[model samples]
Target: MSVEVVIPNATPGTGEGPHWDDSTRSLVFVDITQKNVFRWDSVTGSLQKVHLEDEVGCVVPCKKGGFLVAVGRTIFHLEWSSQKLTKLHEIPLKGVGNRFNDGKCDPAGRFWIGTMGKVLSFEPLTFDMEKGELYCLDVDGSFHKRLDKMTICNGLAWSSDHKTMYFIESIPGQIMAFDYDVTSGNICNRRTVVNFGEFDPTDPENLGIPDGMTIDTNDNIWVAFYGTGQVICFNPQTGKMLRKIEIPCKRTTSCCFGGENLDELYVTTAQAGSTEEEREAFPASGSVFRVTGLGVKGHPANVFNGNF
Candidate 1:
């Protein structure tokens, strides 16, 4: 596999939640701390950025038109061409400290998103644990609470058959699997698919916490490790590591499959709380990266079926 820096220093803060828009042939992602949503056109090699008033967590295309965006604790419908944002629904949190994080649309077109506790500090990497929750937004604009008491909820993906859902809880360093009902958009039978145990976010020698993830046509899970400069592939069924791709930046936040044939992997990194030494060591810290020649393809991202 070959890794290339597509956009050098794409964001000044954390870059998370990447989705490939097959209809537009572009890569959509968000810079959380910077409160910016970006779209990079693959064919034209041009970038379009939309700055929002709140911290943007994720962005997904809509089947009917426009786009669905998670900003702060609310979901909004964004008319990209006009740069208009209309609020859809806001999730009620126990405290104001919680906010939306990584999210994506399921095969059935329901938005699955999770929240994280108050960020205490980035330099020392501290946060309030077990204060977050996961919610599912349906096509009818109704919200359903899935799980609660989560710590640093992040990456989410479903199996090729849409029967198994994979979720990442970063602080506990676990990849959870749940039996899913595609039609009803319900998930149950929760179990641990991959457990890295609890990790210390402050320790540079740690194995790294799982952040954002995506699955390939063969059902292999590609997970981006936060503290480690690596994106590891795993066989979810066997819970075994298959391959590993080294990234230039240590704080690799998220990744997705893009390209015309969906054979390329796009990764996003962060430079928000990096020290001077780290910035010098990894010059492409906040850049967007593209990995090609992996010999595997992924399914096109699902768009929200709701007609706002």
Candidate 2:
């Protein structure tokens, strides 16, 4: 396998979500703190970006048209061509400082998104804990709360069979599995599939916090470790590490499979809150990378089927 920089210094802040747009044959991602949405076309080798008014957690293509985006506490429909945004739904977080974080669409076309306590600061990083919740926005413009009391809700993915849903909660450093009903968009039977707490904290390899994730065709969970500079593949059934791909930067935020065959792994990193020593160690900290020859393909990204 080979790894190379695709977009060097993509963002100064955190580059969180990475989604492959099959229709456009491009990769779509977001820079949370920067409030920017970006699209990089594979065919033309061109990049497009749009700055939003609020922090953007994730962006997914809509089945009908345009794109579905999670911005701050609200969901918006973005017309990329004209840069028009229409507010869809907003979570009612009265006095709580919570905003949407990482999210994606399930196979059945429901937009599943989660929120985290508002980021107080990046440098010397600080945020409230256990103030997040997960919700599913159905096709008919209905919303359902799936889970709550989450701290830093991050990566989300579904099993190939669509019976299991996987999620990541960064603070506890655990990957959770849920029994999923694709027909009803319900998730239950929550259990831990992988726990970083089981590893020795003193070990350098174990220092990374679990962050964004994706799954291969075989249903193996590939998770990006925030501080470890590695993306590790784990067998969900056995909860065992299968392989580890090292990144050039420490704050490896998220990854997704792109390319025409979905064989290339596109990774996103962050340079926000980096110290001088770390900046020198990883000069390309905020770049997006593409890994080829992994010998595994991913399922095409699911688009939101919502009418709005």
Candidate 3:
């Protein structure tokens, strides 16, 4: 019943992927458009941003120190101290106008990532339902393309038991579930888990867009609705929405649980849809936020250490 938006004022245009760092008890996220990575400590209310020359789409802490960054069309291992970027792999399809989008590490320590067609140009949407493949880079340095033909591969989460996987495709607004085999880190039996209704172009509130998501300790799924200004919670098994957290910003991009005890929910918002006047009115449009409640703590993702 009680909700408050922390960090309501922050820099705008932040398309971020959040990572929970247990070592420092801080929540890390990036402003992809701004080319900056931030570490927020809930205990001291400290926020630190590291400037980078290139756009860093996602950041996952590396087990050996530094971070594995998913930049525009390639994945790299970054050494934060020296500002060095080492290219790891180039996603296979460059001609299709598809580029890496959302990514996360599976429980098996393999990184799962998806690509989307560039929306700026007239190029047909690169989603090949057969080509928009999900990929995994094992600790052994071998790469595997898991699934494909996905348009804007977004939300990715694994159940606590590591037997189920949840994924989302942004355009059509569908959340899918897969039966995951832990032994081989393979997924199958893909099925629709949830679907949002269409929005009336005349009414703003009814439009629900799919974005990033995080799973709670109790298996509840919290998804950020890109254009809806809200985060909806759902029971994964029943596909029922249990609650919604209202956000003031129109483009709520992503969320994750991070804190000393992992009880606080940190959210990232964007100024992607702001008009010139609206942009000036809300300068910190692309800032991070925090909220409490929902009784959930996220499982920190494991970084690849080059060991199979």
Candidate 4:
């Protein structure tokens, strides 16, 4: 089946991060280029926008009627009522190019977030400023250690059993897995789970880098390709690409399993850095899309406890 772009011409430039909020039964996404947070309900057909001062990276649901949000450099605990946000906690960062990119909470309600370098006008994509790192913050006001040296980190996900952790280093086209100790929140045994280069010999550079990811019940990982026009599904065990859901957009930013049965695949796309002539090529560039009959029921979203 083909994936349909729901919000046609929704965002202007970079419409990046998306998170499915089960509590409100709607999808929350952000336009990094516009610095706007949007909540769109498929059931009621209502769309709302919360304009923020700084660029927003990721937004996950919280336990006590709030959300955990990552702005440019700090992670904040926010309470949203009447579409207004109140700050709770702020986690600081060190790198200039570094900003929070992709994130999600594990089974235990700990938010796992990654940082990436800024796209400078002059510099090409290279490992700069210890660009990416993984961090964990528990619900008990406990701060865990950070994973170091990864550049352009994206696509954070966990296996069905929560024993395996999967992540992607976007530009280099590397997908890695770690032996996750859930109890201690420590990751070990870093090994390559999926490498994108070997899969496609033709036009690897322009095919796009991996962005946001989600896990199916069978432990399959669905990754949105940044420059490529497809969402690739990989078997976690073998790192083999089983399916590719082709989208008609240039920049497929992120995807998640939504809908009542959690079978519908909701995807977010971007028109971030496109030129005038290039924009004419893809009209629905920065839009949200959905596909059904995937047969994967995703886990409900984790809510961050207000006290955390």
Give the range of the ten consecutive residues with the poorest summed lDDT in model 3: 121-130
TM-score of 2: 0.96
Q: What does candidate 2's lDDT look like per residue over 58-135, in tens digits?
A: 999999999999999999999999999999889877335889999999999999999999767655455787889999
Candidate 4 lDDT for residue 138: 77
- Superposed by TM-score, candidate 3 places the C-alpha of residue 136 at a distance from the truth, in angstroms, of 1.3
TM-score of each: 0.97, 0.96, 0.88, 0.91
Candidate 3 overall Cα lDDT vs. reference?
Answer: 0.74
TM-score of 4: 0.91
* Residue 5, candidate 4: alpha-carbon lDDT: 75
Better of 1 and 4 by TM-score: 1
Encode model 1's per-residue lDDT on 209-293: one tens digit a residue.
Answer: 7999999999999999987778999999999999999999989998999999999999999988889999999999989999999
Tens digit of per-residue lDDT, candidate 4, span 1-308: 75787777677767766777876789988887688778898889888887777778888887776677778867776655555565544546566656777888887778888877766642123445557777777777676646777777788888877798898887678889999877767889999887765224256555567888988888888999876678989997887889889888867888888888788888888887766765788788888999887767777755565354
Candidate 1 CA-lDDT value = 0.90
Model 4, residue pairs in steric clash: 62-304, 63-303, 63-304, 97-118
- How many angstroms is residue 295 displaced in model 1 relative to the true structure, after the best TM-score fit? 1.0
